[model samples]
Target chain A: MIQLEKIEKTYTAGTVQTPVLKGISFSIHAGEYVAIMGASGTGKSTLMHILGCLDKPTGGRYRLDDIDMVNLDDEALSHLRNGKIGFVFQQFHLLDRATALRNVMLPLIYAKEYPADAHQRAEKALTAVGLAERMSYKPNQLSGGQQQRVAIARALITDPAILLADEPTGNLDSKSGTEVMAIFQRLHRDGRTIILVTHDRNVADHARRVIVLKDGQVAEDRLVAQPRDAESELAAVVDEEVRP
Target chain B: MRTLRIAQEGARALAAHKLRTFFMMAGTIVGIAALTVIMAVGKGTEKKVMKRVNAFGTHAIMITAGGGKGFSPPQAGITTLRLEDAEAIRSQVQGIDVVAPFAVRRDSSTKAGSNQLQTIVMAVGADWHDAWEWYTTDGEPITAEDNSTMARVCLLGTLSASDLFGSQNAIGEDIQIGNVRFKVKGILEPRGTSPMGDEFDRRIVIPLTTGMRRVFNQDYITNIRVTVKDSRQIESIAKEIRQLLHERHHITPPRDDDFAIFSAADIAKMARGISGTLTYLLIALAGLSLLVGGIVLMNILLISVGERTKEIGLRRALGATQGDVFHQFLVESLSVTILGMVAGSVLGWVVSITLARLTQSPVVISWESFALAIGFALVVGVFFGVQPARRAAKLRPVDALR
Candidate 1:
């Protein structure tokens, strides 16, 4: 669960003050699938950064699971980022030198939790994302689709309560984008909370709730019907019936 | 465990860049080599000088008569050093071992067949053998009976025999010294040349009575040589000898006494002073080389830090502590220095040995110098390595990543 009240963020570029996020308020409950959509420079990414605890809000109250995140120090914030939240970026920023399995193990290394079983858990996460066969391959050796799958696996390896993806399908082809959406759909059905930021309406359609932003303010919030479970529908296929 | 993993990673990275590592170690090698060679030369020169000083004989004191002021008329045809003075010194000085009176007559050439050679003929009492521990290679040394009888016999030095006989045995041979024939009794062993390049084994020895009665026909002697029981007591013994000689010569207040006392200990001290100065100069020169090597290390490390910025950024993003980065660089520098030290030590020893052989000088390597050279290199490594390591450690992860 996450909450933000009137969060304001400002940037100083050579003595000139620029405001990115102004008086934005939002909340997401556990196991909820939410999508935040905005055009370029709408502060959607900045909001996502604040929500993930990667950056601090200049003026506001930010609480995650009733704990005040705004009051935590840098070290404590890093701990929270490592232990409570998993991130997936648009470009799938996996370490270039490590194998897919090793990239998944990075968060566990930072948290110092389940160190002895990290390899096993990483393998299981790779299998969950249908990447068990490519676990030993580095990011450069994988395709755009496979690389995104590895990033998703890394996000799920820590078993964090919330998954935050920033433009997860921005760099993928249509087919790979559909596959990535299917994986997200499955993760949501498994009772994990997910918040996805995108500028594409098609990507927003996969979520149960959509929030649109304009000029650093939330313009619309609506509940939409959940997309079909594409993987399970394919799994339910049967041979041609006699009447057909 | 984390440190170990990081160190291993650092090692792998260093190994990947072999040329850079080799270049880093080159400076250290040259520095250590120069230090080792300098120290070896200093130690070897010290030993050679000390050996030369000890060659004059330990605990032996020489008392020479000085030319006094014009007011004190010179004793014409008189020898102030007499048997009485030798007796008094032997009887009064508690630590005196032996005392002998010596007189010398300069002879420019001695004729042996067709060849002529310069020589110094010294007449010494029989106790000279006991006082100086002179050994003969052939016949026996001159005895007390020979002194009493004034025998017409002489001892030839190694060089003197070689000049007279041309490699032939000269034990029973005769040589003419100032129109008088004296039979050669023994040949002395060759003592190497002095610091002044004077050949010590180029003189002849004869009985004191023979030289005075047969050759010069004078009853006076030139100087007295006194040997003490122990080298440590030479100073006290020399003082005693000077006091006794002063009293025997009947000089009051002893204003610039009739004799000057010289001890081997004094010569040894002088030699030590010269060698000490040389050693200091060499150590300073070696220190300069080490300084240069340290500068080279600093330059190379700075360049390396700049070139490896991306690698450092990657490591930081992987959760490495700043202290870990510092240690990695420090270890790399130290490894280079240590490797260079070992190579330099071996090189220095070879150089010292080759120099000793070529120059015919004694080369003595001391353990203390070896240890000091190594320690200096390590200190230089640490001293010059810290700045670069600090620079690498202080780089911010965000800035470096960008």
Candidate 2:
């Protein structure tokens, strides 16, 4: 579960004042699948960064599982990011020198636990992403979709409470994107909390609830009438686009 | 497990840039080598000088008689030091081992079928051989009976025997000295050259009574050679001998004492001082070279840090702590220095042996010098490595990742 009240983020770029996030508030409960949608410069990515504890809010309070995030030091924040939340980036930031298995073992390395079972758990995570045979392949050796799968496996290796994916399918083709969305839908079905960020309406539509941002403010927060399977929903959207 | 993983990652990163790592290491290796060579040269030269000093003989004293003052025409006086004075020193000095009196005169040229050489003939008493630690190569030395009877026998130095007899047996052969014939009773061994480059094995020796009665007809000796029991007591023993000579001469207040005593220990001390100075100079030169090597190491390491900035950033983003980054760079620097130390040690030994052979000087490779050189090189590595490591550690992970 995550909660934020009147969060603001301002960055100073050499004497000029830039406000990326201004007075934004939101909440998400456990086991809920939510997608945040916004146009460029609407602070969705900034909000997601704050929610993932990669960056802190300039003003206001954030609570994750009743623990205040703003009061934690940098090391403690990193610990929270490692132990409680798993992150998947749009660019699939897997370490280039490491194999998929090694990449997935990174969180456990930082947490300093499950050292003996790290390899086994990493293998299991890769298998869950349908990448068991490609565990020895480096990031550069894998396809774009396979690299994203490796990144997702790395995020899920720690079995964190919430999986925060920032535009996870943005770099993949439609078919590979559909497969990634199907994995996310399956994880949601397995009762894992998922917060995804995207500008694509079809990707947002696959979530149980969609929160849209306009001009640094939430424009809509509503549950979908019916949640379709990610593959069929993607096909339906493609069909509608062809008709138009 | 975490530490092992971090170390493995560090090694992998270093392996990725082999050329840079080698270049950085070159600085340390060359520096250590220079230090090793310098230390070897210093120690080798010191040993050579000490050996030369020791060859002059320890705990011995030389008393030369000449140049007295307070006379109307500078008093070209014959200060005839008698056998009585030598006996007085032997009886009165507490640490006296042996006292031998001798007189020298340039006698004559000896010829053997066309080749002739001028030689100094020295007449020595019975204790002279033991006092000077002389050894014979052929025949036998003059005995106490020969000295007392003033026998007309002489010992030819190695060069004298070779020149007169052309490597043939020279014992019992006759040679002309100032129109006087003296038989060669023994041949002296080759004693090598002195510091003044004089061939000591070129002279001739005879009984003191023979030189006084048959050759020079002089009744007194020119010098007295005194051997002491121990080198540590030479200063006091020399003083005792001086006092005894003053009493025998009956000189009041002993102004100049009519003689100058030279202690072999003093000469050894002087030689040691010179050796110390030379060693210091060599160490300084080596230090300068090491300093240059250190600067080279620092320059290369700084350049490496700049070149590997992106790799450093990547490692940091991969969860490397600041201390990890610091240690990684430090290890690279240390490896360079250690390699240089090994190479330098070998190089120093080679150089020392070559110098010893070429100059015919003793080369002493001291373990202390080797350890000091290697230790100095390690210090240089740490001294030059810390700056770059700190700079790398202070780089922010986010900025580096970006």
Model 2 ranges with Cα > 4 A deviation: A1-6, A12-19, A23-37, A40-54, A62-69, A75-87, A90-114, A117-143, A156-244, B58-318, B343-366
Per-residue lDDT of model 2, residues B93-161, tens digit only: 787888988887653565655658787677898788898898787798989999878787889889888
Tell me, by TM-score, which candidate is best: 2
DockQ for candidate 2, please give it. 0.18
lDDT string, candidate 1, A1-244, tens digits: 7888998989889999989888888888999999999998998988887887766889889999787989986556656766678778786777666789977876665554446888999999999989989999989999998999998988887788789888999999866777888899889989999999999998888888999988888889888876555454334442222236
Clashing pairs in 2: B29-B340, B33-B344
Report clash pairs, candidate 1: none
Indicate the docking level reached by candidate 2: incorrect
Q: Estimate the overall C-alpha local distance difference test score of candidate 1.
A: 0.77
Give lDDT: candidate 1, residue B265: 72
Candidate 1 matches the true fold with a TM-score of 0.62
